[model samples]
Target chain A: MTTASAEPLLSLRNVEVVYDNVSLAVSGVSLDVPEGQLIALLGANGAGKSTTLRSISGLLQAARGKVTRGEIRYAGQLVNTLSPQDRVKLGIVQVLEGRHVFEQLTTNENLEAACPVEMSRAEMRSALDRAYTFFPRLAERRNATSGYLSGGEQQMLAIARALMTRPRMLMLDEPSLGLSPMLTTEIFSIIRRINREEGISVLLVEQNAFAALDLVSHGYLIESGRVVMHDTATAMKNNPDIQEFYLGGHGVNFRDIKHYRRRKRWLT
Target chain B: MDWILFLELAANGAVTGLLYAMVAISIVLIFKSSAVPNLAQGALVMVGAYAVLAFSDWLGLPMWLAIPAAMVFMFGLGIGIERHALRRLAGQPIIMILMMTLGLDIFLRGITLAAFGGSARRMDLGISDDPLFVGQILMSRVHLTGAAVALMVFAALVLFFRTRRGIRLRAISNDYVASWSVGIGVEQGVALSWALAAVISTIAGVFWGAVQGVDQSLSLLLLKSLTVAVLGGLDSLPGAIVAGILLGVLESVVSGYLDPLVGGGSRELVVAVTLILTVLIRPHGLFGDRSVERI
Candidate 1:
């Protein structure tokens, strides 16, 4: 993974979030991400990685238990008080974990729904064309209801929908979750391609360190509401600490685990 | 009833039905935006009629100027209601807001009674007051004009909702959070819907006043509008209008023909029956969105 030669695009300093009065999800965490770089947030279940992402996006208000005691700057602006929509307008878009692409809308309509380019309809049409070029599967199933799309295809649609907003940065929560290995590979490969070819900065939060670190330039390991380690993907991958705790170590990849096959597996 | 008389009564019922449909359409617009039934809608119509009458008689505005002026005034009044009463109650219980608007209706009614003395005022609106004889049957020229006005207004509204502004309103109604995230001014959109509904209600009231004469008793018209909206669907604008006319026609036929056996006053009975049937069959209304529960 090669780091981009540019100033940091997003920086979080000692950010803290506490739910209710008791649960401390994230505490005093900080990280800097440069432009056009893919950064992965790795942790186990309930690791506060999602909470950190949510705080940056302004979805989880600091006034709530999801409070931020430190500074969060995006493109050199303090965005702690900005609303989620304002954050989105300012080129920070998050695809929620479950790929909740407006289920009632058609695939193309769902893509069209997030369109923030307040230009004439003609401009919007060209934007759609560019988005379709990236995700041809969505273009093919343009008229189909989004609910009918497979998990993989819906993930692609979510990415495409975020692209329509023309964001400089994208925060995706577990793009590979609940997806088949082949689908996961395709999703990450496209994300890597988007980062390399299109210069779009990506901040991805995933439990699968193997897949997430495969594309990220740097990785932040969160454990119990704190960043246990922050290093380059190469360093983190090779570090014994990450392998011992986060991953089951021994380079034992979950993708290689297989069992006896049955004929015609159920999709669900 | 004979076929000849049946057709005549049906036509008459439909003309009146158009007026009720127009009123229901006003209610539907407000309901979609605010999720409130807007009890003042009937009062709004009466206000428009009174405004017109007052302008022509007291203020000396001509018919052309007076009508538009009344419409504009009602539009302001509608926005004022939203800002003063409804805006504070946002996100509150639906029944609480309903009661609040009901209180508004009563307040408006009291003002009209105080100022206008509850007397029906005759106006020379210059519209055709003579009934046109269609062969043996006679239909009032005013009812015919009311039907045409209702149809034209309905068409215009349908076209407006199909436009960008209309899509914006529907989007706000469907998901307020999503609409806000998409850079839509939700407050402005809701206010615009209320204003538009107020304009429509005012026009309906003016037409009703011209046909039936203006009086404080006209506030009962909102009851009919409520019935129309409930039967059609709370969120469906087209449903409100169509259900209104259908209910009107049914009431007409039932009351004219069956009133003899039922001892008259069957229109109210017909509305009650339609309300029960719609609630049982489609709780969301004929054209309202289906409530999708999250798992």
Candidate 2:
């Protein structure tokens, strides 16, 4: 994807995040989401995937965490000093780790509040309609207090809220977390639909590798706060090491797999 | 009959409640956005009132000019305080934030004493304080006017929240980080909430000082407003208005009947009891959004 005079929509070059000036949360994580591309960040909990996303979007400040080193550029300009809200204006929006919808607001109000620019009544209504079309469940529960939404519904609301901002790039953290397989499928389809129809660049950080890899064209694996691997989704899916280490990667011989796990050099 | 006495106290309480609503709303606005409870809210009200004194009475500006100038000053002061003191302390423990506000209260009070002195200062907004009788119920026109102003402010606030900026306020209050990523300008939102609260406090302080007379005792208004805020739910704007009025009535009624039966000065005791009871029963405040669990 690297071509002269063409820049990735979102680029992180060796970004490092340190909390409380000491503990490193993310380090040397360099990757890109080219415009019109959907990229997957695959990692387990504590792999600093969320930190990378946070550093990119500037939420690190809220948690007393700072990006100590490296650069994050959006649309070919340095945005490391920009506030989170400024990044949103640049269309760099992040749906945080949990489904962090405004619990106190109605689903409709949640979307209305996320609007990036002031619009007339008719304009705002059409904007909301577009969001509702993305998740019809949200339309059904538009006025329901979001705190009462089912976990899956809340996740949809979070995405819907992010969409209301008119994001050029949507960075979502763990959209499939705590969702049942059926609901997970429903959400992933909507996400895929959003990408296909809207052309919003996606940087999806997920522990649910199976669901995300299916939707993404490219993938990066992060481990211990560092990028461990990168490939096209198809190549990563068939890669022997990834399947054995992740993706329930085991042969039918359970004892052999257990012995293989014991002897695994990476585990040590 | 005692029934007449009850009606009188109730009417009186409601009037006072409206004025308290001003203080309550200011506290609620800051608390909703910043979650610090703005211990200096009452002090801000005191400063706002004293600003009017400095503007009109001291500087010899007309009442009309003095009022707007004071409000503008208070708004800037609020923004400055948030940007200067509170911004640096972001992500601190809630206790630390609260104590910082307490320090602000002290600092403001010291400044007020130095500027205006400890003696009570009086200023009127040209509203008559004459008694108006309704079926043997006596009402002060000054207070009735204050109630009208409070209602207008409350209505204006309700309308403001319905606007784009207001929605952003609610969003910031609900989730600062989420609001930030949606282009809501969290720092500016925090500063604006403080500035908005300060503007409200100026209005409240002007009315309050006009009626109660300006003194160090004005700072005590914070405690009563905080009670209203807690009763209403610190994050709920409507909650502050409703709880403020309710607490005002409760205080007036308790002090009128219950205080005399015991001795005197039952207002503070009643407020304390009500706040404790409300905490035990509905810790989230009456209008506060329920912290529902979805396990």
Candidate 3:
């Protein structure tokens, strides 16, 4: 599944992100998302997964975070200095965590708001149609205020809004967070459809290792801001360490959990 | 109990309220996008009056040409202030931004004083001062024209918000990070907000100048407009309109009936009391959205 010879759509090489010029959040992280391929970045809270996504999208500035080292290349062009809007123009978009949407606006208005300023009325109509085709639930509630949407519905709207940009690479911070198991499966299937049908490369960051590994061909395991393990999803799922700590497999005694952390093969 | 006097005062108050609504709209525009109350709004209004005077009276441009020229000049000024002054202070505390606007108010006032001198000047937009009769209620022609223009501008704004660009601005106001991720330029939106606010303030200043001759005191319109913005809820556009009218009528009725009893000055007192009561009571104003917490 690794298209190593092809130029990746987005490649982050030795990226280091520092916050407020002092605290280091992500250091020496490297990864790639090949064209039209779905990739997963699996990590726990504060593991620098979201930070890496933000650095690529140029949203780090808002959090007073700066990329101090390494280069981020999109479509074979260095995008380290581009503004967030510029990055978006070049077809990179991120849906932030916690389902951020224009709560005051209707679902229709939320989608319309994401269209480029130069988009014509005809183009806008087509774009709306495209979003509706992907998330039919949103079309029914198009005129309802987005703030009142159910948790699952709002997550769908957030993804639909991101699609309004017609992005080449869609990076989701966590599409499955807080969603019920049933809703999570539904959303993941739709994400797979978008990747397969629209040919948009995806970089999904999720803490739900089971669902994320099921969705992507390749996975990167991040720990405290570094890429600890990168392998094909099948290879990672079969690894004994991953099965013990991440895949919900029980083998060791409860008291030895802390000791097991020290024995992680990758850490050793 | 003069019924006719009461009706007359109410009519006049409503007209004055419309003018206040125009100014309040300007303040609301800036606050919506940046979440900073533009304390310099009144100063912007005062300078707008002077800018029009400089173009029409000094540069000898026609009234039709001068109005838009002044708007263009102020538009550039608005963008400049946001880019050079306010943009640099991004991520600072909200208080720092508030203080910066206060500094802008004083700086603009000083510049106006230095350039235009400290004398009252009549801005005759050619609207007659004669009282016009609308079925027994006498209204000043200038007031009627000002109200008509304000209404038209309000209608235009409502329509603007329906456009794609306008919707983008609204989205930016709703959430900056979301807007940024979707490719809406947040900085440009903030700059555009300031430019539009400055343009609206110019229209406000013109009407205010027409009603009462322009002078250093014109800058004090900020106090009345601020009262209206706060009373209307700082972020709500319709709230500004309703609150402006409410404050206007309240002030007029207070001044009309109570001024004689109190010996001549109660309008300012009425405004102060209303503002205090609003802050203490409804704090979110009549139309402002109450912050909601989702469990």
Give the best candidate by lDDT.
3
- B119 Cα displacement, candidate 3 (Å): 0.6
TM-score of each: 0.81, 0.92, 0.96
* Candidate 2 residue-wise lDDT, B66-96, digit = tens: 9899999999999999999999888877788
Per-candidate interface DockQ score: 0.21, 0.76, 0.90
* Tens-place lDDT digits, model 1, residues B220-255: 898777888877778777787788778888988888
In model 3, how large is the Cα lDDT of residue B223? 91
Candidate 3: regions farther than 4 A off: A1-5, A251-254, A265-268, B292-295
Q: Which ten residues in a row have the lowest lDDT in candidate 1 chain B?
A: B286-295
Query: Ranking by DockQ, best first?
Result: 3, 2, 1
Q: Cα RMSD (Å) per model?
A: 6.8, 3.0, 2.3
Candidate 1, residue A185: how far the Cα is off, in Å: 4.4
Compared with the real two-chain complex, what DockQ does model 2 have?
0.76
Instruction: TM-score for candidate 2, please give it.
Output: 0.92
Q: Model 1, A126-171: lDDT tens per residue?
A: 9889888878888899999887899999999888877777778888
Q: Report RMSD for candidate 1.
A: 6.8
lDDT of model 2 at residue B177? 79
Candidate 3, residues A130-199: lDDT per residue as tens digits? 9999999999999999999999999999999999998999999999999999999999999999999999
Give the CAPRI class of candidate 1. incorrect
